[model samples]
Target chain A: MSAVLTLDHVKKVIGGKTIINGLSFSVREGEVFGFLGPNGAGKTTTIRMIVGLMDISEGDIVICGKSIKNDFTGAIKEIGAIVENPEMYKFLTGYQNLLQYARMHDGITKEKIREVIELVGLTDRIHDKVKKYSLGMRQRLGLAQCLLHDPKLLILDEPTNGLDPAGIREIRDHLRMLTRERGMSVIVSSHLLSEMELMCDRIAIIQNGELIDVQTINEFTEQATAAFAFETGSLGDAATWLKSDWNALMMEEGFSVEITREQVPVLIKKLTAEGIDLYGVKAVAKTLEDRFLEVTTK
Target chain B: MGKLIINECAKLFRRTGTWVMFAIVIIMILGIGAFLKYGEVNNPPQVNPAWEQELAMQLEADRAALEETGQNNATLRMFYEREIAVKEYQLEKDLAPETGVTLWSLMSEAQAVIGIIGVFTIIIAAGMVASEFSWGTVKLLLIRPIKRSKILLSKYLTVLLFGGLMLTVLYTVSALVGLVLFGMPEQARPYLAFADGEVVERSMFIQLIYNYLLSSIDVLMLATMAFMISAVFRNSSLAIGLSLFLMFMGGTGTMLLASKFDWAKYVLFANTNLTVYFDGVPPVEGMTLAFSIIMLLIYFVVFHLLAFFVFAKRDVAA
Candidate 1:
């Protein structure tokens, strides 16, 4: 896939202290790329730089092959972003806010505005003052505002920050649909690992202003060693026999060993030949959260 | 750029505060008209046939006083001379003192409302950029395809536009109220001004409009200062507090300093009241309209430079 955004060792320094230290990353087109990091880990800072809300001390950001420093208007024209919480004018109605945003870009007709409002599920409350809308409703309105320009890249910093379970699901589903339908790239930052695992095609983990790793969710989660617990009639005998050739630990009703899927049958046959009746065996798979903790903590 | 300015204007007009401010201005104008009308109905100005005799007596007293002490004070001498010139003109023209209400007098009196408009404009200017940051709407504004300078300029221009709108409302409402309370004058009057060591007659309507524009110079500068503060600090309270304080007290404070020091002429407050050069002398000696204009231009450029530079370079962290 072609890259939609590229950060060439972007750096942010404030008052002699480095906030973001030589961060480099690329977001490919038509993918939901997750930026996973803890609080104060420079996630929002990076997002701010990407959206041109903050200046980069060194290096440059190129959007759609246009450098932000050289051609700011050209680079920014293709992006729609919400840096943090979706804060808008409380005095204006949701539809008015959308209209105000629509005026900022060319060729945004009234029909396009209505279409985006409908897409974000804000058509019902679009005429209500934003102050009267709930946080979830505001988020949806913000989404509607960003979509009015039909941008190529959507950068949302902590999109699910103050959302409930249902709200989070709604935003995730909408993002998925947007990517699928429009072939738009998205860069979403969050501290929630489970949501990232479910929503992102690829995840980049950052810690203390440094990029630790970036990989597909399956690769990161499935790298953990798998283990199997065999329930045998003679647990003691099975543990004794497996301990010589394999790493085995005795349990209350079975013995467990760290092995792959292909080793399960051979171990069972060996157990039966050794006069130990094998009742059953179960495989324990590690979850994404477990792997995330392991990787981040290290 | 035009679209950005339009968007800014739309946002500004949508606020409840903007409408409330407009209501306050209209109400204030109406209240002034009512008070004037009440005064006109209750205590009618007795157009005394002996008004010339009374003016002659006052002039005699002022001349005597001037001979005694005005020689040492240039300001007192200038005031006495101008008063004498005005009285002489009224007597020579056989015109009674304009105690009766007329549309011309009402418009002249309504110019005072520009101060209130200045206050309102200052508030709006102070809140222009600062409120965007406070409301977290700067993120949306800056993320657009426009440059940051263009966005900032659009907001500043909108503030000026709102100020202009308020001024227009004040003029229109006052004109209408003046017509209702006092009938139009029979003929246009000429304003007596002391110029080149002699009394000169200037077109009254032209002088009134010029005075209005001159009075607005201070407002424009104060609003610009407030705009700069709003852009640099991004704190509405601080911007409003500092600019309003300067707007109300800066002139008085500078006058006090001018009394003690000649160098005070260079201060912004001393130079802000361009109207002083219209009918009265400047507070500080050796200050001329040309000098004040030059000083104002320098300050204007500096304020804009600081505001734009800081806004364009500063990070929008919040």
Candidate 2:
């Protein structure tokens, strides 16, 4: 897939201090790209630079084949973003807030606004003042605002910050649908590792304002060696031989061993040939959180 | 651009404070109208049959005051000279001052309400850019397809429009109230204006309208100053406080300085009342219309430069 957004050595300097240093990344079209970073690692700073909320001190950012610096209007026209929080005018109704944003862009009809409000499931309370809205409702309103003009890219920073489980799931499903069915690109930055694992196809991990790794979700979690716990009736007389052959360790009910997948069948056949009682074998998978901690700690 | 302006206006007019401001302007005009009408009913203005002799005595006293004005105090000397010239013209033309308050005269007095409008506009202007930051909306606002300068320009233009509306309301409602309370003058008398040592005739209606606009110069400058500070500092309270302080005290302070220092003519407040120059008095000697206009233009350009520069370049971390 072609890159929908590109950041080339993008840097942000404030008061002679570099906040974001030489960050380079590209987000592909029709992919939910996740940005994972520790607090104070400059994730929001990078996002702000992308959306022109912060000036880029060095390098260039291009969106949809247009440079943001030379052609800001052309580049920004393709993006819909919510930075940090969905801060809206509390005095205006949710619908009026959406209408305010809809007017900023071209060719957004009231009917289109209705469609977006429906998509975000804010149809019932869209006309209520935003001050009365709960955080979740404001989030839905923010999403509705983002989708009004049908932008090519959606950039949401901490989109699930205030959402409950159901709301986060609903947003994840929506992001998946938009990317898969409509070929739209999404850039999501969140501290929720498990959610990012479920929601993103790929994630970029940054630390100290530097890009550390960018890999698919599966690649990230699958690279570490797994421990397989074989639940059986004690190993019988074969316990000593099993320790010698497989380097097994004793457990309360079963023996746990670290091995590759291909060796599992061989070991199982040998155990059965020895007439050892075998009940179950399971691989304790390494979760994304485990891998994320492993990667970030390094 | 039009849509942006509409959005700004929508944000402004939707707030309760905005409507409250308009209501205050109207209620003030009516309140003063009622008070003046009460005074007129209770104690009528006495029309003296020897008004001509009274005018001559006043003119003579003005001449004495002019003589007492020291050679160094040119501003005071100019004030008395203009007074003497206008009174002399009234005496020679056999024109008598209207003893009773006329609608035009009441409206002129009611023009003090424009200062209230200036305060209201300053409040609006101070909050225009600063509130977005406080509300955490500037981050979303700046990420649009439009440029930052355009947004700031649209907001400043909205301030101008709001100020103009307030001025228009002050003028119109005051006229309306004055019409109800004080009837039109017995005969339409031209306003006597002393200019260049000659008293000139100007239609009272047109002259009042002209004064209404010219008097707004100070207000426009203060509003602009408030807007600039708000944009540069992103602090509404500071913007409001600083601008309001200047609005109330700047003119008097500048006039006091202008009495002592020739350099005070270059100050903002000294030139703000360009209407004074039209009425044949300069805050400082040798201050001309062309020179004041150029100074105002310089200040206007400088304020805009500082506002737009800081606003366009600052990061929207909020």
Candidate 3:
């Protein structure tokens, strides 16, 4: 797929201090790309730059083949973004608020507005004032707002900042459906590591205004060797050999060792030959949070 | 641009405060109407049959003063000359001073409320841009597929449109109340205006329309300044406070300064009241209609430059 959004060595300097230091990335068509970072990691700053809310100190950002600096209205027309929170006009009803945005665009229809409202499941409360809405309802209205124009790219900063587990799952499902069915690219930033792992197909990890690495979910968690917990009868006379040879960390039921898949069978046979009592074994999976910590620390 | 203006109007009119403002305007007009109608019904100012004699005496006094002054102060001398000419024309035409509150006179009296309209326009202009940031909706407002210049222009246009609306409301209501209380004059009395050092006869309706527009220049300038302050600083109260302060005190303060310094002609308030060029004496001597118009244009361009530059270039971090 072609790149829908590209950031070529983008830099942001505020008050003579560098905030985003030469960061580069691209969001492809029809993929849910995740922006993973800790607090104050320049995630919102980068999103702002992409949406043309802030100027880039250096480099360029191209959206839908249009450079933001050269053709702002043309580039911005292709994007539907929420820079920070989806701060809406609280005094206006949801429908009126949508009308406010719909007027800014060229040819958004009333049916289109209704379609987006229905898509976000806000049809029941769409006529109510936004000030009466809950946080989740506000998020849904915000989602409806961005979807009104059928944009080529959607950039959501901290999409799940104040959502419950159910709300988060709803947003995840909506994003996944939007990508698969609408053929739209999404750049989502979030502090929820587990949520990102479930929601994103590919994730870029950055820290302290610097890019750390970008990897697919499977590659991010997968390593050459895996850790296994070997449950056995106290290794009788085999404890000394097992500890020295495998560099094992002892656990409550047994000991865990890091080894290859091929070596597991070989070690099992040796343990049986030693006449040691053995039990079932299990493999431990490294979660995205663990990998995030490992990558950020390095 | 059309859609943006419509959207802005919807947002502005949907609020309750806007209706409350209109209500206050209507109520104030009625209150003034009632005060004048009931209080003056018992005794009318008896039209002095000798008013032409009185005007002739005043005209003689003004002519004598003009001869004795001998251009000691050019502006004062001009004022004396214009007064003498108008009084002489009033006597030559056999025109008597308005005896009491008439419909046309009440309509002219209603012009005092234009200052109140100016305050309302200032309030609306002051809050137009800053309220977006304060509500935190400027994030959504600026990210659309429109240029920042167009958006700001639409907003400024809407503020002017609202000012027009309020002026219309004031004019219509005052006319209705004035007609109901005083009724039309028995005969059409032509309004004599001093122009080019001579008194000219003009229709009252046309004169009132001219008065409405010329006085609105003051409101338009204050609203523009308030809009610029709101855009550049993103603070509505500061804009409102400063603009309203100037709205009330600017003329008086400029008058005080015009007495002491010649450069006071360069001040913005001194140039806002363009009516002085047409009928009355200018605050500063040697200040002409062309000079004031040029000064107004300079101030206007400066306000727009500051507003647009700061709005289009600044980082909207919040």
Per-candidate iRMS values, in order, are: 1.0, 0.8, 0.8
| Model 1 spans > 4 angstroms off | A164-166, A227-259, A263-282, B57-84, B194-204
Model 3 Cα lDDT, one tens digit per residue, A176-250: 999999999999998888899899999999898999988888898784357888898877668788889989888
Record all residue pairs in model 2 with backbone atoms less than 3 Å apart, i.e. clashing.
Answer: none
TM-scores for the candidates: 0.91, 0.92, 0.93
Candidate 3 lDDT at A145 equals 86
| Residue range B40-59, candidate 1, lDDT tens digits | 89988667888889999988
Which candidate ranks first by DockQ, i.e. highest?
2
Chain B TM-scores, listed for every candidate in order, come to: 0.90, 0.91, 0.95
Q: Per-prediction TM-score, chain A only? A: 0.86, 0.88, 0.93
Q: State the lDDT of candidate 3 residue by residue for B213-299, as single tens digits.
A: 899999999999999999999999999999999998999999999999999899999999998766677998788889999999999
What candidate 3 gets wrong by more than 4 Å, as runs, is: A224-283
DockQ of 2: 0.83
lDDT of 3 at B26: 90
Which runs of model 2 end up more than 4 angstroms from their true locations? Answer: A229-258, A262-282, B63-81
User: Which model scores highest in TM-score?
Assistant: 3
Cα displacement (angstroms), candidate 2, residue A267, comes to 7.6
